[model samples]
Target: MGHWSRGEIERAFRDYSHAVVEIGRSSDWSRYADLFTEDAVYLEHVYGEMHGRERIREWITATMSVFPGSEMPFYRRSGTPSTTTEAGSSGRFSTA
Candidate 1:
């Protein structure tokens, strides 16, 4: 994989955030599936793990229907940056 600069990482995250906001506003569940890769894995702390984008989309749609008008906001904790450096020579920071 190619090295990613801090600016590139931040821009990618910003783009992802914008996509999420648009999906929420439109309530377009299919757009949410488009955000993930075909083989992407989704692990919900309370709901267990779901494999594949289709499965994740189904779960998200079902959950959203159950809890209408709910929102998922991504916020960083005070005093902590949104990204953290990983150990080793990767030089890549993991999003919080």
Candidate 2:
């Protein structure tokens, strides 16, 4: 893996967090899909896993409809990317 500076890691996280909040607020499910790679996998502990960005987008849309006005909380953390295998996996918290 290429070396990533701490600033780069933090900036990436901040950008991701902002995107998530904007997507949630706008209810623009497609935008959510755009944030991930085409083969991205989304795993919800209780809900199971979804493969591919399209599937993840579908899940997010359906979830929003099921629980209207739900909002996901955003958090920021300081850490190196090498700390985990997953990008942007520092920590996540959401509310419905």
What TM-score goes with each of the models? 0.69, 0.68
| Candidate 1 residue lDDT tens string, 1-96 | 569987787778667766765676666656887899999999899999999999998988887767657554444435433452222343222343
Model 2 steric clash pairs? none
Estimate candidate 1's alpha-carbon lDDT, on a 0 to 1 scale.
0.67
Whole-model Cα lDDT per candidate?
0.67, 0.66
Per-residue lDDT of 1-96 in model 2, one digit per residue for the tens?
569986887679666766776676676767877888999988988789999999988887787667757554454335533322222453233322
For candidate 1, the per-residue lDDT at 38 reads 95
Model 1: worst 10 consecutive residues (lDDT sum): 84-93
- The CA lDDT at 69 in model 2 is 71
Residue 93 lDDT in model 1? 21
